[model samples]
Target: MSTIPTTAVAIEPLSISDRLSLVWRIPLLVIRCAANFASFCLSNGEIARLDWRQKLAHAYLRASRVTLTRKQQAQQRKLLTGPRIQGYCHRYNLEHRAVSVNNDTLYKKRDIPTPVLHFVKNPTTQPDGPTIFYLHGGGYHNPIKEQGHIPLALQFAAACKAKQVVFLEYSLSPEQQYPCQLIQAVAGLRYLLEQEAVQAENIVLVGDSAGGHLTASLLTHIVHPSPYAPPIDLRGRQLKAVLLVSPWMAMSEEQIKVLPRAPNDFLTRESIVRFSNMFKPGLNEVWSNRCDMHDAVAVWKKLFPTSHEHAICRKAMLAVGTSEVLLDSCVSFALECMGCETIYVNGQSDLRLVKEADFVLAIAPGEAHVQPGMDCALGYHDGKMMKAISTFLEAC
Candidate 1:
């Protein structure tokens, strides 16, 4: 498919409030990281002792260096096209080659060509270790590469003593819609189980933002598929756990407008609508768009189909920052899930701590969307989220 041209928008000056938000964020991140490291030490003495201090330090330093502004985000949107994303992935590969044990690209070989899957195994870890199937988020239109995120993958692998990390580079929207990405995900899952000979019990599914939505779809399909949609035969397999970071699981154009704005949120209501439009057919175009013939919205409804039945994984963990715009939606989704209970950590009462008897919701105060991943690696409160994810995965 031909790449769609992205129109560049002129950078706009930040409002005074936005400027002050950025100024306050730097020190806040440092303070939060320190507080979180201390909390980890207190709460998880054994895991904390396993060289997380260095990881925490690295995350803090990185958090201080990268700050996203409206202008920068606008510029970023311009660079999310096919060729630019291809180049971005190339740069990621070049940059992370030194740390990666084995980095190979593989194709899913679907009817419609899907994006390449970047599989990076931990060089130091022994083979047949646990695997994390990671999906990066870019609102479904853009994708961040594994190179950008492999450090966190490595950190998880090291801390959990896991073996491999597979980053699925699924096809984006306006080019491929709905089931294309989902199909690619099932195919990738099949590869891990069948080709790599990895046991399903040792596999963990992790995704951020739109990637989280995809992950949710994959899990729900495995657990209870929509009768209307084509089934993904899991080959009698299941995953150990799932971790969703700021998942856009049940988003609506109406909900986006009503969501409370966060100081650090790069996602805008318009962007959400625009991205949704790419894969989700509008009321007027539902019949016209071939991808929507099977009804993607129906599939989404099936995925979230009553929070009560949403616990597809044996164990699940959700992390969202209190300051993120998606906090309410994420919390609501968690609360609706079966057997979920709310718990408070660190006296952050405003933070939603929804958990099923088996699920974990790690709410980081004053953090915003997708902070624990490579893009916001070492950002404030990320240490907290990472600590939560590590603890949950280890327990599972």
Candidate 2:
């Protein structure tokens, strides 16, 4: 049989003019606005670490424009399809060529390095080496955290004094969808189990946004096995703790609008549907154009059959802005997961010490879900979230 032509090949570009304002326009606009704002947020002091992305975003902004001034037009041309962007991307590759670590201790504070079993070396630490499985977030399709995040990951590993780290490079979307990414994450965990690096009790799973969602999903999966579940060989590795920051917990369109409105929110309502559709093809179509076959409002239910979240590993934290639509869903998912409890970190609510049972705390400063300084991402909160993570990594 002839291979079926993919919808992506047959469908038109996901443009701002597309209908179902939530699906394409919202995400595209937010991304563009974030890029444009990134242009504005650039500083000379941190030019090396930050300027390139700002420049890239600016370039994309320029490419996205129609008519422009000489400078603007020049910038767009350079950014849209130029060697400057390519050069920047190339430099990034060389820098990450060897992800080696300095053996010298940076500080002797309480840090937990739950090294991943797959990457651990026995220059020889006992089975007691700390283990942390990391998950990166980028609205399901974006995984370009090599620069701004790798350093932080290295530091996190060093802080934990872990021998190995499991950085999950989960699948991308527009093709792959719900449970798919979660399934891969579970597979990564099982990889650790197979390597015999650590046990469930020694493992600390860390994730931000979409990563967090997968972490939650993984936890949910193991606690409640499905026919689609991957076999778990938990002989040596014990799944201990989980940490999520501004996690994208809910897939329903109703929850997408929960996020606090910011100038450049990383996630928009429509993008949620776009990604949702990515998982369950025929899930939901961008409303900009009327799809005779899809509907975003109830599209989510049609995508994933499991509405009730399964309880898996115990929770360390599930932090989000009250303004974020996913907040309530995160809370509900944790609460519903029977055995799992969550630390409700509030961005718009009180940042007090919640009970630390199966629960934890938050430190939102009335900022957006993942704002720049507070968040490593353009609009997310990885920076501030790290503080919470350090506390968790040290606590137990």
Best candidate (score: lDDT): 1
What is the Å distance of residue 15 in model 1 from its true position? 27
Poorly placed runs, candidate 1 (over 4 Å): 1-111, 145-148, 226-230, 235-237, 281-311, 347-357, 374-382
Model 2: residues >4 Å from true position, as ranges? 1-128, 233-238, 257-264, 281-315, 322-325, 334-358, 370-383
What tens-digit string does per-residue lDDT give for candidate 2 at 37-74?
Answer: 56446633222233343334433433344222223222
Q: In candidate 1, what are the lDDT values of residues 217-306, reduced to their tens digit?
A: 676556555332345555554567777888885455565667776534545566677777887733332221212335544543443344
Q: Each model's TM-score, in the order given?
A: 0.64, 0.56
With a 3 Å backbone cut-off (N, CA, C), the pairs that clash in candidate 1 are 59-378, 307-336, 307-337, 307-338, 341-355
Worst 10 residues of 2 by lDDT: 1-10
Alpha carbon lDDT of each predicted model: 0.57, 0.44
Quote the positional error of residue 290 for candidate 1 in Å.
21
